[model samples]
Target: MTTHRRLVLALQPDMLAICRLEPTAYIGNDVLNGNFVAITKTDEELSIICPQENMPEEAIYTKGWRCLRIEGPFSHDTSGILASVLAPLAEAHLSVFTATTFDTGHVLVKEENLNRAIQILTQTGHVVRSENKATVPYAIQ
Candidate 1:
């Protein structure tokens, strides 16, 4: 039997920018000071995400991303939560860029895709709301 879990997601107001650099590229202090800054280096590329305005003028990036935050202080043992959320978006042909903090997961969908994403989430039984609204408790059923 398939079990449904209740999840509450809030749309964040800030616009996020993402940049890509060469594998060995070094980022300066300014970019690191963004409201949200992330850097990842793999064998092929170094990718970064930060508040849009903080992105260096010279950096090559794709901007205009809106964040949908999953309300969580989720325990370390929580499993399949991301999969549960991502599966529906994937099925709807929506693409997402995901970032995880210690306490929660932030999924960034292009600004144009935000509304469609919210509709899909709500249709799937997840509560989608703005960050400022009061949140109700989510239960895993």
Candidate 2:
């Protein structure tokens, strides 16, 4: 039997950056000013994700990435959400970077591969929607 999940995913319209800094590095105004920013400090490094335009030069980061927002206020107990999203991508050999906020999950794939990622997801029975009409899923069966 094939199990299926239907999710409403929205692709964020802006390009994003993944920034990395020393563990003790100061968080700057630029990162804070980003439209959407996620920061994590571990023993080795401080990692940040934010709108590409707001990233500072001091941080070592990757640019030209786009995000897919899983639309939800998913219950804390919900299981397999990320697994469901990731399995097909893994099978297709597409690499993704993921993060989760209190309400939802964000998946980032390089800009060059966005269309292919959407096509792979749609083929696996997920709806991939974007800010513009162009990236809408074609047919999922």
Candidate 3:
């Protein structure tokens, strides 16, 4: 069996919303102003993940998400990083939505599952720290 190294993830301090807009819809300043935002445009729709309080008025969204950022400046050829983290969560039956940037991966789990998710990750040997400096064994509000 191949052993994977434990990952360190940082929990962002903002409540987020995932929104879907028409593919042609214009993105506004509200989303751009968030401390963390991700916008993806596909032929079928435009998906936006941003701070819940900054979502556009016309968005069709699901609220109450918390983000976990996998610490990295991993090389482009790095493999299995995301899978290693996600596999354990999947085995625990936790639902997650993920996004990747040039440097790292981000996982978003609904607010109701945040504590359980953190527990599962830590139990699996990964370290989770909060951006707001909350101690380990996270007690996020």
Q: Pick the candidate with the highest lDDT.
A: 3
Task: Please write out the lDDT profile of model 1 over residues 28-132, one tens digit for every residue.
Answer: 777776445777789998888988877767678999997878889899799866776788889889989998889988888998877788777777788877767
Checking candidate 1 for backbone clashes, the offending pairs are none
The reply for model 1, stretches above 4 Å from the true place, is 1-3, 32-35, 134-141
**Model 2 Cα shift for residue 129 (angstroms):** 1.6
- Better TM-score candidate (2, 3): 3
TM-score of each: 0.81, 0.88, 0.93
Candidate 1 residue-wise lDDT at 118: 77
Q: Write the per-residue lDDT of candidate 3 for residues 18-125, one digit (tens) a residue.
A: 999999998778688765799999999999999999987889999999899998989999888988888888988999999999999999999999999998888888
* CA lDDT, candidate 2, residue 67: 88
Ordered from best to worst lDDT, the candidate numbers read 3, 2, 1
Which pairs in model 3 have colliding backbones? none
Evaluate all candidate structures by whole-model CA lDDT and list the values in order. Answer: 0.78, 0.81, 0.87
TM-score, prediction 1: 0.81
